[model samples]
Target: MTPLEILSTTATGLGAGLALIIAIGAQNAFVLRQGLRGEHVGLVVLVCMLSDIVLIAAGIFGIGEVVQAVPAVVVVIRLAGAAFLLSYAALATKRAFRPGALNASAQQGSLNRKVVLATVLTLTWLNPHVYLDTVLLLGTLANQHGDLRWWFGAGAAMGSVIWFSALGFGAKLLRPVFAKPGAWRVLDGLIAVVMVVLGVKMALGI
Candidate 1:
């Protein structure tokens, strides 16, 4: 493809991705929490972006097609993802009701690098909706560009970087709210509701 075509395709893909990922969800909430706590926001953003790049690249190379053909894999992922989401939702609901504030410098929870990596993996890879977002939707939209598929993928990847960085930083704005016990309760409740609803949708295959 020509230079102009590549630029156009990438720009289109970026726009599509930004539109798709603006909603409040588990990933967003987690990143925001970390950011507000001033706990490795850059690292969180890096992990989120890198993971997205891998998924988007895989999708561009036909991972989506393979996944579509594997009905059993799809079912397994949906079931597992739903279970996880529901569990998380329950925990969030409990947290919401619990009268306690989140200490930003809480020396209680350990944040080892390996644990952090695991956290990113579970949040990014293990989430079923992420597959549909980066793999299915972005992949199909990117493939529409004929020979400019790479450009589209690049743009989508860039969007992921921009988004996670912005989200992680923006989350700091909520530090005051997150510091309050009631605010945490409310946030947790919202997270619970969203997660449970999404989990139910997945379980029902809707």
Candidate 2:
């Protein structure tokens, strides 16, 4: 591809990637919460970014085709993802209703680094939508770029890095607002709702 073509393809991929990722979803909610609480934010961002890169690569390399060929795998993922989302939703709901649960200082060490890592990983990997978006959709789109598919994937990967980094690191700017217990309650309540909706949709295969 020529310089102009390379830039165009990469830009297209970046746009497509951002379109899909910049949304209100379970993964985003978790990342936002961690970012607000200032709990292992860097690790969460890194995991999310790396996970996107790996999935995008898999899709661009024909794993998307394999996934399409085996519907059972997706079904399994859907069910598991729903279960995890619902479980998290329950926890979020509890936090929302429990007074002082969202206290900034109290939440500092409430969850250990290992637990936070596990939660973020589960949120990323177990969510079937991640595969559909990063693997299948992005992969299909990149392949359409022909020999420049890798360039497209690179663009999409860059988008992932930009988004997660901003969300996780930039979240500290909102610390003042989140300082109030009421704000935390509202955020947790919204998170619970998002989780329930997504979990239901996945569970019913909607």
Candidate 3:
């Protein structure tokens, strides 16, 4: 591909990636929470970006075809993700009912690093939508660029990195607002609603 073609392909990939990820979902919710709490925010961002890169690469390598071939894989992932989301929603609901202190240090100490990392991985990897966006959709779009597919994937990966970094770091600006217990309660309530709604939708295949 010529330089101009490459740039155009990469830009398309970037826009597509941003469009896919910049939505209200479990992954973004968790990242936002971590950012607001100032706990392992960098780690969360890194995991999300890396996971996207791997999935995007797999798509560029034609794993999307395999995924499309096995419909059961998507179903299983959807069910698992749905269960996780529902459980998390329950937890969020409980938190909303009795939100404890909103101090970052107070809550941050309760979450262990390993647990945070595991949660990040689960949120990123277990969602069927992630596969749809990064693997199936983006992969198919990248292939339209022919030999420039890898470049497209690279651009998508860059988009993921930019988004996660911005989300994880930018949420800190809300620290002052979230410092109040009421703010945390409201946030948790919203999270619970989002989680439950998404979970139900996934379970029903709607």
Candidate 4:
């Protein structure tokens, strides 16, 4: 590929990944919450970006095809991921409705790095859509160039890194917005709607 073509391909890859991630979801919510609170910003961003890289790389390396071929396994994952998504959505909605401290970062509890890590890990790995995007969609598209597959993968990984870093840090600028009580409600509610819709779509094969 020419330099210009390479740039174009990488840009396209970045756009594709960003399209999937820009919407409100568990990952975004967690990252935004951390950014707004100025807590564990680096940890949250690193986990999210690394998780995407690993998942996307695995997808490009034929692992995704193997997993997709196993219908039984895929179906099980679809169901389990659906359950997790819905549960998260429910929790978010409840939080949105309840009267609580606005600054969750100030809550009386450990940051729970393990809990946060596990949540993103599960959401990244278990969700069938994640596999479909990284493995089936992006992988197939990347394979079109045969020897240049790695370039496509590189583009996607770059996108992931850029996105997580931005979402984590960029959200900090919105601290005043998120700090307002109404902002949390709006944010959490939007996330809840996104999660529940995504969960049902996966469960119902939409």
Best by lDDT: 2
lDDT-best of 1 and 3:
3
Task: List, residue by residue over 1-206, the lDDT tens digit for candidate 3.
Answer: 68998898889889999999999999999999999989899999999999999999899888999988998999999999899989999988987775363443455556889999988898888899888878999999999888899889988998999999999999999888887657877888899999999999989877
Among all windows of ten consecutive residues in candidate 3, which has the lowest summed lDDT? 99-108
Off by over 4 Å in 3: 99-106
How would you encode candidate 1's per-residue C-alpha lDDT over 1-206 as one tens digit per residue? 67888788889988987876777766777787667657777888898898889988888887988878887787888888788779878877776665453432342243666766566666666677777778888888888887888899999898888899988988777676666545655666787898898888888888
Question: Compared with the true structure, what per-residue lDDT tens digits does model 4 show for residues 67-87?
Answer: 767878878888998899899
For model 3, name the residue pairs that clash: none
Error of 1 at 48 (Å): 1.5
RMSD of each: 2.4, 1.1, 1.4, 2.5
The regions of model 2 sitting more than 4 angstroms off are none
Instruction: Give the Cα error of residue 58 in candidate 1, in Å.
Output: 1.0
lDDT by candidate, in order shown = 0.77, 0.90, 0.88, 0.76
